[model samples]
Every structure is written in C-alpha cells, then in structure tokens.
Target chain A: MATSIRFDPIRLPPETEVLRGEVRAFLAEEIAAGGFDPRGGYAAERFDRSFSRKVGAKGWIGMTWPRQYGGHERSFLERYVVTEEMLLAGAPTRGHFVADRQSGPILLRHAPEDIKQDILPRITAGECTFCIGMSEPDSGSDLFAAKTRAEPVDDGWRINGRKVWTSSAHYADYMIGLFRTSAPADDNRRHGLTQFLVDLKAPGITIRPIQFPTGKHDFNEVVFDDLILPADHVLGEVDMAWKQATSELAYERSGPERFLETIEVLIELVRVLGAAPDSRGSEGIGRLVAQLHTLRRMSISVAGMLAAGEEPMLQAAMVKDLGTNWEQALPGLARDLAAFADSSPTNRATFDSVIQNATAVAPKLTIQGGTTEVLRGIIARGLGLR
Target chain B: MAEADTIVVDVATRIFQDLGDPQTVNNAGDDSWRAPLWQALTDSGLTLAWVPETAGGSGGARADGFAVLGLAGAHAVTLPLAETLLGGWLLAESGLEAPQGPIAVAPTRHQDRLTLAQDGTLAGTACQVPFARDCDSLALAAEGADGPVVALVAGHDCAIRPGLNLAGEAKDDVIFDGARPRLIAPAGADRDALMLMGAAARAMQMAGALQTLLDLSVRYAGERKAFGRPIAKFQVIQHDLARLAGETAAAVAAANSAGAAIEASERVDAGLLLDVAAAKIRVGEAAGTGAAIAHQVHGAIGYTKEHILHRFTHRLWSWRDDFGPESVWATRLGESVAAAGADELWPTITAA
Candidate 1:
C-alpha cells in the first residue's frame, strides 16, 4: 500500500518574521532610491551587480552557510525570507540568484577545500556569478545523454562541447558544466557523466546569445573548444554527477521563485478588477489566490523538511510541478478575470503589458528546472509505481 | 503536532479502526454499526472534543479536534462525528453546555439564517443541515436583537425534511417556525466566523479522503495486470497516478496549514479567513481532480457501488458543497484580495 504524504504544517518562526520585516524595509529603501521598479518586468531579468553587493552587505547571500566562508550561518528559513521578499518586490536578483540558491550550496557540500576557499567567499560576497551548463543540443531532460567530452590531461581536463539554453552564461563568471568522461555502461546510462566547475573567462570559450521570441536576451549557447579545468574543479566523484545532481534539486524545485515568477500579473489583475468585482471576476481571483497560497504552504513545508535533515525529494517535485503549472496559468487566468474591467487607458495599458510579459514568460516556467514530465516520473517512483 | 494532539488523534484513529472501518460497514446490510460507532466516539469524548469542561463536556485543543476529523474522513465513516464536534464547539463558544447524544449544527450553508425573535422563539429555515434528522439536539446560530446568538434546541421540536447527499448521508432541510431553545447565549463568533471554521473542517476531511483515494489507486495499479505486466508499468498510468498524488499532497498541505492557523489564532480574523478560504478552494479543486483520476485508475471496479472507492469519493463530492462551495469562498476571498489592491497582495499573503 502507498503510505500517506505528510506536510507537517510548518510555520515560519518569529525570527523569520523579523528578518522579513528587515528585507521589506531594505527593498522599500532601494525602491525609494530608484534601484528597481516593482511593477516592471525589466528588473526581474536584469542583473545589477551593485544591488547584489548591497544585498550581500546585508548578509543575505549565502546566509545559511558557514561564517568562515563569508556566510552569516543563519537558518535556511531566514534565507527563504530574504529570497522571497526580493522576488516579490521584483528586485534585480538575477546577478546572485543562481549562486545563492544552488551553486553555493553545491560547492559547500561537494567541492574540495581549496576550491571552496577560493570560490565560496566570492559567492557569499556577491562578487561572482554562476550559470548551470547541463543541457546540450540533444540533451535537455535526458541529461545523461550529454555529448560534451572531458579528456584528462596533465593535472587538468580538456573539455570540448556545446551547452545550449544556458541561462546567465553571457554575464556569468563561472559555469558548472556536466561533461562525459567515459562511455555509458550497458545497464547504467546515467553513469560516466562528471560535473566540473569551469571559469567562463577561460580560453577557447564562446557565448552566443539565444534571444527569446519576447526579444529577451537571457539565454545563451556556450561553446567550448578546449576548455581546461584543474582536477580539483570536479564536484563529487567522476562519473557520478547524476547522484550529485539530484541532491540540490529539492532545494531548487521547491522555492518561492517557482511560483512567484508571474505573481505580478495576478496582482495587476486584482488592481484592474477594483474593489467590487462581479461574481465571475471575484471567483477567478479567489481561485488563483487560493492556489497560490496552497503552493506557498507546500513549498514552505518542504523547506522545513530540508531544515530538519529530511530529503523530501518527492514532495519537492510535487511542489515544482504544481507551482509551475499554476504560475504558468496565471497570465491566462488574469486575462480572463480582467476582461470586464474599466477600459481606462492607464488600466488597459498596465494590465495588457503585465499580462503580455507574463504570457511570454509562462512557457519556460514548466520547461525549466525539471520538466513536468520528468517531475511526474520522479513522483511516480516515490509512489512506488515504477 | 504536539504530544496532546497526537494522543487525541490516536484515540480517534483507534475508535475508527475498531468500529468504523469502511469495508466492514460497506459490506454490512443494515445500520447496525452506526450506533456502536457513535457510542465509541461519545465514550472517548471525541464527539464533544471541542466543548469546554466548564461547558459540561470534554475540552481539548482545537488542533486536536481538527486532527481527529481528518482521521474520521480517512475512515469514511457515515456517523455524525464532525457535526457533533462542530455543534459542541458552537455551544462552548457561547458558554452554553452541550447535551449528551449526537448533535448537529444548523446553517451549514453560508447564506442560511435562523432568527432569535423577541418572544425567545427561533425562526427561519436552515437548508442542507448535515445529520439534522439523526441528531439528538441542534446547536444553531441565529440573528438576535443584540447580535448573533447561539442556541441549543432539541431536534424533535423542529420539522426536518429528509434528504440525502451524494454520500447517502443525512442532509435534511430543517425549519424552525417557533422552536424554543433549551439554552441560548451570546455567541463570540459571527456567522462568517462559523462558516470559516466549518469550511476548514470540511477541507481537512476532503484532504484525508484524497489521501485514501491516492493510496487505493496506487495499490490497484500495482496489482492490476495489463499487456502481460502490471498496469503501473505503463507510463501513462504512472503519470496519471503521479498527478493524483500531487493533487492529494496539495490538499493535505493546504488543509493542515489552515488547521494550524485556526488553532494559533485568538479569533477568526482576516488572516484566518484567508487561510480557511484558500484551504477550502484548493482542497475542493483537489477533490474533484483526485476523485476522477482515482476512478480512472481503478477502471470499472472503482465505478461499482460495491467498491469502497465511491464511499470516499461520494463524501468528497458532498463535503465540497457544505459550508460553502469553492465558488462561494473564492468570491469572498477574491473580493478581499481585490480590495487590498495590488500593492498589498504580497503583504497580505506573507502575513498568513
């Protein structure tokens, strides 16, 4: 029999509330200083190095890591507060988001001492940026099928491959590239793949922008001819990147970012609807808010489980699957709810712009991180269906 | 959960396991198991779990009562356990003593109203009152001259038109032409507060039912054979079951969070309203999606009345309509969110 899934009703502690207030005050001050626009989509995708340094100065970046590594040694929940507040305010967080969320933690756990000593401090100081190089031309969801080769040399590895759809690579200082070290075994296709931390400024490396149809320049294709990395750059064991790749996913999949991506549109929809909306409008808004709240609760519960040292991989997948789908649908739902709103020029323009941007971004939410099909497969394994 | 909450849930689970097993009750022809189940619930004080000891009933934490309700839902019992607990809670909130046998609360529907007249008689009709005909007494909320009042009235005094929900449980239309309350007191909670509380309870029940449906569907998929292999081996079935599991997890998380919020709150304020409303809406949606996926996984066997799946699914469908449907709660919640405007939406959500 399949056992029940437990969510434990985890509530944020009083300290988290205190931290949230601080974050809000900081964001408010930044907004007053014209650092970013809360209502505009421009800030969400933009990387502001100075803003990231200010956030790092506040000890928000790598807040959950050790103090010796320039971290504040705070709780994960506290870090959660800072992250969510930034996302909600549409702050320019793209500069340090990937490093703070996944790369920093991965290095903290799996990297060697010298690598950690060299890179961890820069990440915590928000002076560096990281991008994931997991997907290739034919290896998007099936990551093990990556054709990138890393041949061993004297005291280093020569990597030669192409990584497509690599976010932030154009401005990133480093890329955590997965490479094929050997041929896959007959029974284990996931073997022979290795994770290497590569400096993007290295020789024989090129980054070409892959512009979206929305005219956004966020993604890039990174080409490597003979990129060399020292032996210490490899994360965890060689040919065992698959196992290491999954450990950070629970953290990656179940954060406020997954659901809050297009929340501005929903907020804009409510503003357009005014106070006394019709039953249809009210019902639509209500269902969307309810769904958002539920996703947040589930995500927080997963965070709590992580804090308690439980690997709730299945629950995290569920959160990402449901949260991404909900966020992706927010634009359409908001469009429908705002159908009968007053046709004032200001209102129409604001709603239309917000919805248009959100709609353009919606398609990538489900496809990024882990695809919906892959997540469901993970959940099926959790359910013992496979 | 605290230790006391765990003990309370354990007691309720033990009682349900002993006397309220779904398969056992479904296989039986008559209503023989109902009395023993009620008696066991009463004996353990589970029926009056929320009433205060000062109000002549066993007192427990609100979280404990909610946890027990989840257990009751998992068992898919047809008894009036949830109704009685809500009734006792109503009476306790008004500083009135709860009566002995099974009790039902009136105004289960959000818009249903009862009035306390100058002559101390209760009037107005409460439609779709759960277990109205089966209960010994009714704990009702009525609009009084001062404000909303809670009244305890014998079930025999009022006229009840028999009705049954999709689950085949009592859902009668109760009319109070001039029924005199045995005891009436000033209620601390208003109509909206009571509705929110009741909605939260139903959300928990739906969550529990969704869990059981997920488990049954998974088990069936693992056992049922197709194309010389287990049906679960098929990628399509695995995906469907995975979706069902996701829906079930969402419902569980939402309901549990709402219950925890209610327990932590001093009163039914806007924060609690947000939690309860969200829980009700999300869990109701989950119930609809989860039941369909579960039945699909079970195939024809799950469609039959003889199967235990419908017992839970039927109640899941019926309970979604109680207190307030998804649309009703959604409208209220939506109006509030819109009124708060775009700038305050994140703050309001983060507060909860």
Candidate 2:
C-alpha cells in the first residue's frame, strides 16, 4: 500500500508575516519590562498568570475560535505565527498554552453551550487554566488502562481515582479528566472511558507536587477522592472519551511548541560559536539549523492541513516523533559544539546555564506529551501495519 | 505542487513505468533495457527538460524539470537523465544551444575547478563527473580571464577515466587538456550557484528514493511473516516503518521547498542558498537513516544483491556524496548563519 504520509509543502500566507511582526514587538516589550528572561528556561516553565492575561489581552488566546467566545476568529496560520513567536521569545506561556492550544478547541467541539459560554471566554481572557487528566497511577501511554472511576451520585458523578504527571493541576481552574464509566467490552479495551469537566476547586481533590529531576514543580499528582461533578459536566459520549480524544491530539502534537521547546540552547550555541567558528562548531550549528528548519516546515505543513479541516493524524504523529527527538538531542549537541568555545565568551555563562537546564529538561520532551512509543504506534496504525 | 507540476510528474512517471521499472531492470541480465529507456526519455524531451526552447531544448518550467528528476529518483533509473538535464540547463544559462545527445557537467565537486586558457581552451580535471564516460558532450564551467564562462566541448576531446559510485553508476574523472570548445560564452552563474542547483536536484532525487524505500518497507512488512503472522503485526517492525515514513516525509518536504524556492526566484540569492543548503543537508540525513531502517525491516532479503532494495539504497547513499555531502553543506550554511549573528537565525529560517 502507498504510504499515507503527506506533508505537502505549505507556506504561511502573507498575513502571517504581519502577525509575526506584532508578536515579536509585543514579546520584545514584555522582555524589556522584565516579564521574563529570554535567555533562561526558568521563566518559560513557570505559570505566570499576569503574562498570560497580557497575551490574552492582545487577542492571541483562542485565536482561531469564534469572536463570540472572546476569540478573534483568525486562521490557524496566524495562530501558528503567534505560538511560534511566543515560544522562540521564551515568553511565559504555560498558564494559557494548554488551554489555548487544545483545551479550548476540545471544549468548542464537545462541551455544552452553557459550559462553552462560561469557560471559553475565561480561557480566552486568560482568567482560567486547564490541566489534562489522562495519565494515571497505573496508566500512562496505555490510556485505556485508566482506572479512575466516575460513579453516578445524585445529580452528578463522583470521580474517585488518581492522575499522575498532571501538569499545572495545582494551579489550574479546571481539568478535562478521563474516568472509567463502565467495563471494557470483550473486543474493545478502548471502550468505556468517559471525559468529564471537573472544577479543580471542588471538594475532595488533592494536588500534590511532583518535582522533576530538574527540581521544577511543573508536574502534579492529582488525587480525586469522591470528587463531585454535575451531570452536564460529561463531555461528548458518556462512555466513549476515546472517540473524542483521538481527533484533538493532532492539534496538540503538531504545534511549534513540540519542537521549539529547547530552541534557546541553539541560540546560545550560535552566540558562543562566534562569527568565524571552527569547522566542527560551524558544521554542528549548520546541521542543527537544517534539521530545525525541516521540522518547522513539516510542522507548518501539518498546521495548514489542520486549517483545511483535515485530520492528519499520521502526519501529526510523525512531526512529534521527529520534532521531540531533535529538540531532545539539541542540548547534547550544543554542549559538544560549545566545548571548544573560548572559556570566557561574553555570554558563555548564559550559554552554560541554558545548556544545563535544557539537559535536565530534555528527558521529558519525548515522554510528557505522549511518549515516542505511543506516537509511533499511532503512526504504525496509520500506515496500515496493524 | 501546482496542478501543472503534477502533470509534468505524471508524464515522467508514465515514461519510467513503461520502460524503466526497477524490478524489470534488476532481473534483466543484459544492457538491452538501457537503450530503449534512454531513447524514450530523449524522445519525450525530458533529457533537456531544463533547457529553454531557444536553446534547442524543451521549454519546460524549472519546477517541472525538478519534478521529472524526482520521478527519475523514485524509479532509480540508471540512465543519466539528471546529468543531461543539468548540463543542458548550464549550456542554456550561457545562451548556447544544447546538443542532441546526452551531456555531463564538469567540476561536480565544489573544490574542483576548470580554467580557461587565453587561447580559448578548457583545462581542468573534474573528478566524479557523473556519467561522463557515456555522455556525448561536456558542459564546462571554466574560470576565464574575464570571469566564469560556460563552454561546450565534445567528450572525445577529453580523457575520461571511469569510476563507479556505490550504486555502480559511471562516475568518471574527465581531464580536459586544452580541449577546444565548439561554443563558449559568459556564464551568468558561478560555481556556488551550479553547486546549489546540483544539490537541489540530488535532494529531490533522494526524496523520491526515500519515498520508494518507505513503500517497499511497508509492503514487505505486510507480506513477510515471522511468528504465525505478518511481521507488520509486530510493534517493533511497525515502529521501524513509521520512523522511515517520518524521514521520508522530511526529505520530501525539504526537497520540495527548495525546488519551489528556486522556481519562484528569478536569481540565486542568499535566501535561495539557504533553502538549497537546508534541503541538501536534511534530505541527505534522511537518506542515510531511512535506507538503514528500510534494510533492517527487509532483513536478509533486502541485503541480497538480487533484491531491488539495494538499487534504491545504494543510490541514496551515492547521491548524498554528490554535489557536496551533508557535512560540507552544513558547514557552509552554519558559517553563513553564524556570520548573520544569532538574532538573524529565526529570520533566516522563516525567509526560507
């Protein structure tokens, strides 16, 4: 069978250039105002509500959504430009990044009208934050193994289980969690999982900090102890979260954030290498730049596919598989190339610090947003191999 | 690709399918198939597809020629179609008429240079001149007293010592010892420009070969069984094929972007250089990784000389070395990016 992978070379339209300029200017202003340090990754990992609100004020959040929900109703390409610029500038986007990237779109598609009216505007205004509750104590990549149960209680369901590796759960206003509503059918293990919109401030929920090896408190162990949710909080089908989950991942997996997470290291690499770098340094920089350009083009092509309303799941998985691997490798590559740099270059300290942080953070690039193994499996299915 | 470009690719695909099927060529024990394939390509005006109508060649768009090369790559045709097309384009660049038979360009390597004597003779030794032994003429880009000049010289005037690439194609060294040219004119492009063009051509070809590899690996995985089921049922093999597909997509995307930029630009500029260099480097990387994975998925059958997998993989390896290897291009591109400073990196990439 012909390979289904299609990355038709899609160029961003001219309008994107305008949006990019505005984004750069705004990011420059924010950096100047000491909102975040562009050279450091520490600011990037932190959830800054004020910074998110400012970004929302610029009408960048929920950019592609309808105007009625505080969105500008822009094209995906325009949103693409804004997202990439924010990523490259190291702007503190963690507060609204998840909501803007996937949660808002998921809600717009599957949430009830009242819920949408209540939450979409808050998300667009950067007044609300979202944390995904997919991974659990026993289930990570095998999402169907999730045992977090949601039992019917009075006018709602009570969720009683734990979700591990939940990013931003401690600070999030809500969580779109997956809970087991029924037993799996004989042939379909992926059956019976239901999605629910749970208010994080509700009773009987505990958010314990799960520190990464980098000593970053970006992840949380969220335990739900009979957490009550209204009946209308159920998203999409009652026992079919799997169906609702598959389509939204393409948006999550194929964004610029997938690849540009550690781009500061590359920028630091160039700074350390100087203008007339040695052959080894120059070649290393060149190869990385080339790979980065290729990944961006592929990512942008996927974005264009999304804009055209195509579900390019295989293509999206491929981009993430390659993109994450490349970004993860950047730190080591940068270290090797920078080894010969003058020990006292002007930004040598900054370069060393960035590389150190990137090294510690690189391990999660492949694991956090669906592990490499999971994505490859999805791609394999797309290739008709399974 | 545009609709018109698709038509051009379709035409080339049809020609290759009818005469240059890889399996058919692999099984044939003689040189009987080469003649007809070359004849079909020549009659279709694809050999000189890049040359303008005024230059005594087909007046097709540059993008169309690139698409044809990509098709030639997918088929892994042994004929010197890309070489001939490149040579004709070089001749046409100097306002010279392309000859009727196949032609090869000199100084395929960046360091190899041809010099023009005051007496108007071409003098240089060009190494790794693809298909030089088989070509009827040589398109020489010689450094003249005024500047670089493109000279058309008959192949017989030069001494050709033939060599073979990893794929066993002719990669000869041509020694032009004061060879007189039939026609000579000032070349508008420089050595770098020619190298960029050649790199773009090779990148497109590699992309096509990668596509073929992905298809072959997937098809093989589906049919070949190991433990009571098709090997494709295994997760590891499936992941291998998936990774190959990703590499193949990267190669295609990078090569197509470069080709599109070249077609859209009126002249070769720094922006075009960035696109071409990135394409060459990224596609070359894909070729190496993709080929290894394809062979791994295919097992011993793919490793056998009798298998058609070797044809594409060998050529993928060989093409990466042509028009400068990935390291060389990466080094150049890196230096340029560094010279532009760190801030310009994003702007440079976006421009590409």
CA-lDDT, candidates in order: 0.89, 0.88
Q: What TM-score does model 1 achieve against the real structure?
A: 0.98
Determine which window of 10 residues in candidate 2 chain B has minimal summed lDDT: B1-10
Tell me the tens digit of each residue's lDDT in model 1 across A219-243.
Answer: 9999999888899998889998878
Could you give candidate 1's per-residue lDDT for residues B258-312 as a string of tens digits? 8999888888656687899999999999999999999999999999878899999
Interface RMSD of each: 1.0, 1.1
Best by lDDT: 1
> Which segments of model 1 are wrong by more than 4 Å?
A42-44, B1-4
Q: For all the candidates, what are their Cα RMSDs to the real structure?
A: 1.3, 1.5
**CAPRI level of candidate 2:** high
Error of 1 at A99 (Å): 0.5
